[model samples]
Target: MKFDELDGKMRSFETHHDRAVMPEMYVVARIDGRGFTRLTKEKHDFEKPFDERFHDYMLTTVQHLMNCGFNIVYGYTQSDEISLLFHLNENAFSRKERKWNSILAGEASAKFSLLLGDLASFDCRLCEFPNSGLVTDYFRWRNEDAHRNALSAHCYWLLRKQGNSATEATQRINRFNTADKNELLFSNGINYNDLPAWQKRGSGIYWKDEEINGFNPVTQQTVNTIRKKLYINKNLPFSEEYSKLINNIIEISGR
Candidate 1:
């Protein structure tokens, strides 16, 4: 067979199952750390529940992803997972699902591993929503999840510190209600409401217009300029207000 004919035949086998996200739909790529429990707890011994160092590393990784050759409008991270909201008009790789998954996973894993000085990996999956309302709901879901996880972690760690084994802690936490967890922390001298907002609500990264005053060398005059920069929000709102925030981001990005 001719070279071109042979190449064409092999390419079909590789792409036979390929799929692309539909146009006009919002794309959210969620990248999650693989085996991060072992990596964070057993290997690196990062502070339990939350660590500033680990949080900074995750924030840096999210910033890298926001600028890593995609039309991402917003980035969110909590715990060991990241969610990236692509621009509404993004058509990169013709909206190929596999391309987005592979490249995002590779980029996040590489960036995080470099920051951690170890071999770490991440897996990526895409979520598609038909309307902005659904997008708002999606983020709201993750936001609430962060709250639940934070409460559970604080409760679990408290039990562990009180001489409960891993299994005992897990079992106790499993039986506790939301009020019970809060009371547990309260009784132990820790207030769940007093914890850092970032731990409970996660963090959001979005582009903002920053005003800069500088001297124009050629004109020899002071000038004002607008620069686009990423803004990190650690204290995110909840319920209806959170929905508004997500919608506002989508609306501004569309503009």
Candidate 2:
């Protein structure tokens, strides 16, 4: 009935179910926007199919998370979701998945809301990979998904512009195979192959080291320095080459 007694009881109840991730495994945190369909419609009139503004917000949030005390090596975003690949040894939040997920989603939601001046929310889940090959496969899977979604989206919007309702567009796209969708876009003068790579393969964020010369005012000399910074690359590929690229990142992070 005292303050200390009540606090201890409730805190234990909260942490009783906390589970820790294995320390040596690759960890991935995937955060997805909740109810984004209606939220995007009501708050921001995001462009049909894809919008740079919405993606900019997602990218900013990803950058923020990468800097938030975690050894996150790579960040990937597609549509309304973002996935963060954490270094193998990262034990932030004591590797507690629930706390990490909750705090990450909360922080992402807050950052996005501040960036957009509207309330946005994200929900997160953790994925553990035993090896780097699985990591490469995971990214490839998502990139392929982006390719499929991008194709479908462009076709759907094209039909909508041509006066088909939402239901009709879905039904029409449902009938078309991948080749047929590409042909549809080609017939309408839009080259699916020529679309922005980010739209087709999602975007990536990683670190790049640049060497620069810094002036020393006191000594009147120039000092060569290596600066490491986060780089957002939107032109990533979705081919086997891309799998190699992701594997390289995983290898570097492992080191």
Candidate 3:
């Protein structure tokens, strides 16, 4: 055969021999929790406002999910539930939907379970949503609902703290003007109006540092600090083998 014909034959043979599967384009994972109401009630009832402790619990939960091989692309929180979006093609961690879904649920529940172990009040569960739109909307709707419910509850608690009767407190809280209900919170000489944009996006309980320095993502933006270390071992290494394996996966998955 001519050289061109030989080369063409080889290329065609390789193309026929190679068979790699494509990964799914989207994944909708739902995570939910309970016992948070009891926790919130205790915090609201206590003299100390539920800021630092509650915030820590949330940060720890998010960090826990990251460690379990999920990339939290976006997060939205309502009263007790949080909706998180993860990267779709996580071949290193999520090769299959079933395994990835189980891991996500397990990590979230485990974190909350530990955080509330002292109080013995909260439990969490994950909901599976193979449909992307439903999964995304589920969190958005519920989170906003949670925020409204929290405000109403807080208003009632505040009225009760002022020695109002149950009926009176409910009425007063429900009667709060829109502006009053949406008023920003101030603490330790810091105005809620001055917090960073991200901090203001929703109520984040753990961001006490912003109280002192005064956050302004407008002037000072925050970047995600995910990778703590990036070192490859030189000796006793399967580095080349590992790289080939990753490339093979990417190629197979068509990423």
Candidate 4:
């Protein structure tokens, strides 16, 4: 067979089942650290539950993704996971799920590994929403998940600190309801409500406009120009309020 004919056959085998997201659907690429429980605990020994250094690493990764050749409008990270919401019409790699899955995960894993000075990996998946309402609901769901995970993690570590084995800690936390977990933390002088907002709601990275004075050689005068920059928002709202915020972003995003 000729080379062109051989290449066509190989390409067909690989792409026969390929699927791309619809251009009109809101595209969210959620990247999660693979085997991160052991990676964070046994290897790095980062501060249990939340570590500011690790938190900053995730933030920087999210910020990088915002500028990495995509029309991403929002970046959210929590508990070793990052969620990137792109403009509804993003056309990168023709919206191929395989491209987004591999490259997004590859970028995240590379950035984190560089920061940690070790091999860290991420796996990516997409969340598709047909409308703004679903987008809001998706974010709200993740935010609530952050709150739940935070509560469980803090309680688990506290038990370990009191000499409970890992298995025992997990079992103990599993037995408690939300109120019981709050009370447990309160009894230990840790108020869940007073915890860092990022721990409960995760962190958000988005674009913002800033004005800078620039010298225009042609005009021989200084002029102010607006530039887009990535900003990290550690204090994200939750529930209905958070949904409203998501809607507002979509409204202004014009899609």
Best by TM-score: 1
* Candidate 4 local Cα displacement, residue 214, angstroms: 1.5
Which parts of model 4 are misplaced by more than 4 Å? none
Give the candidate order by descending TM-score.
1, 4, 2, 3
What digit string (tens of lDDT, one per residue) describes model 4 on residues 1-255? 999999999999999989999879998898999999899999997998899899999998898878778889888999899998898888999999999899899889998999999999999999898888888888888999999999999999999999999999999888999999999999999999999999999998877789999999998999999998887889998888888888877876773
Lowest summed lDDT across 10 adjacent residues in model 1 is found at 236-245
Tens digits of per-residue lDDT for model 3, 111-230: 866875643232333344444554445544554454465555555655576688979977766677645655613222334344332222232211111212244587695454333321
TM-score per candidate, chains pooled: 0.97, 0.95, 0.49, 0.96
Overall lDDT per candidate, in order of appearance: 0.94, 0.90, 0.47, 0.90
Let me know the TM-score candidate 2 reaches against the reference structure.
0.95
Cα lDDT tens digits for candidate 1, 1-255: 999999999999999999999999999999999999999999998998899799889999999999999999989999999999999999999999999999999999999999999999999999999998888889999999999999999899889989999999999999999999999999989988899988999999999999999999999999999999999998888889988888899999999
Residue-level lDDT tens digits of model 2 in 85-154: 9988988888988888988999899998999898889999999999888888889989999999999999
Which candidate number maximizes lDDT?
A: 1
Candidate number that wins on TM-score, 2 or 4: 4
lDDT of 2 at 22: 82
* Local error of candidate 3 at residue 26 (angstroms): 3.6
